[model samples]
Target: MQIYNEFELIARLTHGLTTRPDVALGVGDDCALLDIGSDSQLLATCDSQVEGVHFTLRTSTPEQIGRKALAVNLSDIAAMGGVPRFALISLVIPPRFSQEALEGIYRGLRQEAERHQVAIVGGNIAGAGQGKQLMLDITLLGTVRRGQAITRGGAQIGDVLCVTGSLGDSAAGLFTLLHPDGTGAENALTFVQARHRTPVPRVAEGRVLSAFGPAVVTAMLDISDGLSGDLQHLCERSGVGARVFAEHLPLTEEMQAIAARVGKDPLDWALHGGEDYELLFTLRPEKAREVIEAVQAQTGTRITRIGEIIPSGMCLIAPSGTEQPLQVRSWDHLH
Candidate 1:
């Protein structure tokens, strides 16, 4: 049997992935060089998805796992209003895993890469020996016009906090997958499952939000850490507080149904269920409506005004017209 070395594996894995014009050097190089032009700023981010921790092979296919691993990183770039240009992937292949399965994973990665016009520049691959798990780590490079990249620190005190798309579906989907019987309807199960497995990064929406005048989108970040927790991040960075109205939260009917069957609060899922990958942005109070309408008309993404930045700290306004300090009970890797 001929043993494949790391170089050969890298060649096979990155085959056919094309780089953008800005990329001076792609694969087969010691380091990837990018020519992000004087008018553009470079954006870089890295993310990892691990077996048993992020997903289980029993519940998710290799392709789904591969797409999500890259999607999460893409969400990071999108949060900055940047265009993803290149990627460096690292794979920890476990024993008994076939080359076909590995290739399928790359195919999944390629699908998202192509959709976003990103390329696989380079990466490292290694075997995990035995009794180990598969892991994928991706570092993505992106570019945005100078002075247009958004951050989490520009929100004003009265800026309205808005979110793209519905929330908690990913978390509810996870629950549905774990507790299948809890999903009374097969359609509900499928919807949530797809949401959990193949989350769409809001790249176009982020770019649109950032394209508006500086006063339009004051602050922004992706909601990978859940709405409640990620909102606090924006608040901390901008040195302001916020109040998220429970009534205004956008929850899908599917999320509601799954929550009811599982005896879980759908609101809680929306608040702290993390990994939604939706954009959480703060907008100028006066022009909020115009920007929202423009985004809806252009991209068809549902934007909801969920809260507003305040003087200090975070709170949640209940449906009964009372306010309580919003807890920071988001996803923590260390527990």
Candidate 2:
């Protein structure tokens, strides 16, 4: 076998690939360039799905894998309150999977692409060695009206911290899948499967946030990492802080029951479990109701106020009145 270096191969292909008009220089050079509307902003996001690290061959169908690969990137765009317009997918498929499976992956990709209305521009594909694992790396390109895209650094003091849907259901569901011995496997597994396999990107909610006006809704982020980790990111980015009320946390019933069965802390998972794909944003005191209503009407996504921003840095206050300095969770890559 010819053992070509990875970077060498990438350079060769990057320089040689054919390109379209929108792709200013395609690949190669220091960076890839593209043309954009005079009044629009370019929104870009990247997501990498590994064979075993992110999914297992035994549990995941290739179709699910492909859809999820793109879904995550779409979630990023949604977090930024941007509208996705196109996508490019890179593939590293091993020989073990039949051609049918590979085609299935593409089928899933197309389905999701159509649903999101994102065009499949083009991408590179490579065949992995017999012993190597398959991988999918996706990059989604999106656009938003000029000055309309949101960022993590917009939250202000006294803003409300709101989230979409119940928390820890995904974590509880994961527990049920991994440990069927848990009594509530029936209750929790379904939610976990949906969370893991096909996370719903909050695109509509994001746009609604923009429409509600930036003065009302300042900071915005998606919970790809756990709530605690992501909230911390938003705070740091905005130079603000948060105080969460445990009693106010909108955790599902399944989460509480399953947490007890598995002897896990429901609060911890609610704070720290990753892959929930929910949006967490800070809204002004006056705009909270209007923002929530507007987003609900426009996107059918529920919004709940779990906490509020404070000058006291990030702190978590339990329902039982237990107060503690909120230490950072370990789910983040930064810490």
Candidate 3:
């Protein structure tokens, strides 16, 4: 039997699942949107981090692991333009895991929850049995105005493509961790590693974008799977295509320095390095300047206009004014 990739398997499994009218949006978005009896809609999303796969003690402390586990889920809620309310944490504990480390993880989780004003309502704990890795599965609940949730399917042709914050820092950080030669500048190494360990969820930015409403904002999703791959997701959902300007991509000085030291193309990392946890969104071409200025002023996060939505076919416009196919080389857990 042929095994499917992460997305192909998701489509195959979720096909024709039963749903009700209350399910405003399901199965194909950053969060599951449901209309409860209120002026707001409920937003739910779940994500997990596994030892060795998502993190390692050698690279990240237990607290960092716990924080990142929740941070990833928070990013999902942010993508939907919602206010996170509660979280339920489930843990798969490997045998003999140190109590001190576990407490540190919980401390980190509490710190993040307090930062976002989200309560840790409840959860379940289970043994890993024969498994040797620790895992954390978190279900986050948030709420948005009755009709204000943003989605990836709302982008239209001629919409401006924008991204929040700089890109490729997390990937560059992971590179430094995996291939540490102790030769890079101390500040650069620290900056990238911190980005990889605990990324800031764009909750404030999402709220500001949502206030603009869908007609103006159009579409959004967090860049957990790389810019090119997630842009492909947005294009597919919106039934349109995109043209990304390679020269316009935002790269941080630290990331560029690390890439230079390693003799790797920073552009490749900007395009395909996953786990930046930044918001990639589309907006009306005419409203681009307004939205960009508002988000910057309100949230203090830099927003870059990298391209525009097209009628069909994804392409990259190079610095030399050459056009080429924009390929998706993002991370895939199931690969």
lDDT of each: 0.85, 0.76, 0.94
1-335: candidate 3 lDDT, tens digit per residue: 99999999999999999999899999999999999989999999999888999999899998898888899999999999999999999999999788898898998899899999999999999999999999999999999998789999999999999999999999999999999995379999999999999999999999999999999999999999999999999999999999999999999999999999999899999999999999999999999999999999998999999999999999999999999999999999898
Model 1 RMSD vs true structure: 9.0
Highest lDDT among the candidates is held by which one? 3
lDDT by residue (1-335, candidate 1, tens digit) is: 56555445667889999779876445532124356678876777787788898988777887888889999998988888878889999999898788887887898899989999999999999888885788899999888777777787789989999999999999998887787664758888888889999999999998888798456899888988788778877887788999899999999998899899878999999999998999999999999999999889989999999998899989999999999999977876544
| Model 2 misplaced regions, further than 4 Å | 1-37, 183-187, 332-335
**Number of the candidate with higher TM-score, 1 or 2:** 1
lDDT string for model 2 (1-335, tens) is 55554434656666756767665324321113345856766777677787776776566677887787778888878876778888888988788867887788899899889888999999999988774677888888887666666678788888989998777766666666566664566646666666677777777777778665567778787887788878877887688889998888778776787788778998888888777888889989987998888888877777889989986587889778987877766353322
Q: After superposition, how far is residue 142 of candidate 1 from its true place, in Å?
A: 0.8
Worst 10 residues of 1 by lDDT: 24-33
TM-score of each candidate structure, all chains considered together: 0.88, 0.85, 0.99
lDDT of 1 at 37: 74
Candidate 2 local lDDT, residue 188: 62
Candidate 3's error at 16, in angstroms? 1.4
Clashes in predicted model 1: 0
Clashes (N, CA, C under 3 Å) per candidate: 0, 0, 0
Inter-residue clash pairs, candidate 3: none
